[model samples]
Target: MILYIKYMVSLRCKILVKDELIKLGLHYVIVDLGTVEILENITQQQHDELKKSLLKSGLELLDDKKSILIEKIKAVIIEMVHYAEELPVTNYSNYISDKLGYDYTYLSNTFSEVKGVNIQQFIILHKIEKVKELLLYDDLNLTEIAYKLHYSSVSHLSNQFKKITGLSPSYFKKIKMKRSGNLENT
Candidate 1:
């Protein structure tokens, strides 16, 4: 049996889902972001209990097909942007469509209607957020970060980063350092 979970985005969320499943005495084959596969079919009592338990922790057991797809889209994007070792070599549309096994136009239309932003904009937003994280880490130069996230060039990355954050990457990193310095003195 496969179950979809809403708001299950992080590693911590995965752990919590696993813990809940164990407590319910349910055996699961997989507990990934936004989805789980179980060996045994869940009884209504067990399902209700699991749903209530997850809700207490700010998660939800989802049943709506469209909502499930939307959450799947979010999970894929989060995994790609934050957890994956490298971004996809292909374009975002193809990557997403291939991952979900759906037509890109349908997925794009649904996402735009529900999220009020086009898929490309959504990808750019996530990419910019990743750039901010890399900048804060100080492990990679701007050029390296650009390449890692598959940006055309450092200039393109900088422009998008500035447009989203209203600050240059250097200025953002400087702010973090300045804040850390002030905290150390206090």
Candidate 2:
């Protein structure tokens, strides 16, 4: 049986879920982001126990088809933005469509309806967060960040950063550095 889970976006979450499954004596064939495939069908009692255990860790077992699809969409996007070694050369829509085996229009409409934002907007938000993380690391220049994140140009990245953060990238970095310095002194 394939189980869809919400908030299973990180490696830590996978470990937690795997541990819980082991404790419950459930044999899982695979545990990937937002999904778990079991070797055998679980009884309702086992399912309820697992659900309760997972709830304590802030993960949710999705029962509805729509919710499962939505979580799958989110998992794919999260993986692409945060964990992918390199961005795909094709358009993101095509990549997502091929990955999920759903029509792009259908996926976009479903995502917008469930999330109150388009998939493109979600990608941009994740990209901005990634940019902020990279800046905090102080490891790369704006041009490098833009190229790594697949932004067209540094100016494009700067404009979007300013629009979303209400601060220029340099100002944001300075603020973060000041905060870090304060923490070190105290």
Candidate 3:
């Protein structure tokens, strides 16, 4: 039995789903983001119980094909941005199409219709979020972070970061430091 789950975006979400399956005494074959495969077929009652359990943990089982595809797209993008060591050499549209085995036009249209943003914008948003995460770590310099995120240059990274965050990277880092210091004092 295969289950398509919504909002299963992080490692913690995967762990929670795995724990739930174990609690239900269900053996799973795979538990990737947004999808799970069980070793045995489950009864309707078990499915219902599993659904209820997932819901309690803030996850949802997707039944519709379109919704499932959308979740899959999100899962792939999240994995690429947050987990992958290197970005694809090709353009994201080509990469996404090849990865999903769907035409770029169809994927773009579907994602835009469902997400209210174009796929490129979605990728940029995720990239920016990743940049923020790297900034927070403070392990890399801006130039290094820009290269790590595949930005053309530090200026380009700073420009986009400022456009999205309303503050330069340095300023953002300073603000975060201030907050941490204040928290320590409190």
| Model 2 regions more than 4 Å off | none
In model 3, which range of ten residues has the least summed lDDT? 2-11
What TM-score would every model get versus the actual structure?
0.95, 0.95, 0.91
Q: Candidate 2: global Cα-lDDT? A: 0.92
Cα lDDT tens digits, model 3, 1-186, are 889988656779999999999998999999998889999998888889989999999999888888998888888888888899998878888988999999999999998999899888888889989988988975998999998888999999999989988999999989998999999999
Q: List the residue pairs that clash in candidate 2.
A: none
User: lDDT of model 2 at residue 43?
Assistant: 97
What is the full ranking by lDDT, best candidate first? 2, 1, 3
What 10-residue stretch in candidate 2 is worst by lDDT? 2-11
Give the root-mean-square deviation of each candidate in angstroms: 1.3, 1.2, 1.7
**Pairs that collide, model 3:** none
Better of 2 and 3 by lDDT: 2
After TM-score superposition, what is the CA distance of residue 168 in candidate 1 from its true location, in Å? 1.1
lDDT of each: 0.90, 0.92, 0.89
**Tens-digit lDDT string for candidate 2 (1-186):** 999878757779999999999999999999998899999899999999999999999999889898999888888888998889787879899999999999999999999999999999998998999899999985899999999999999999999999999999999999999999999999
Q: Model 1: per-residue lDDT, tens digit, 152-175?
A: 899999999899999988999999
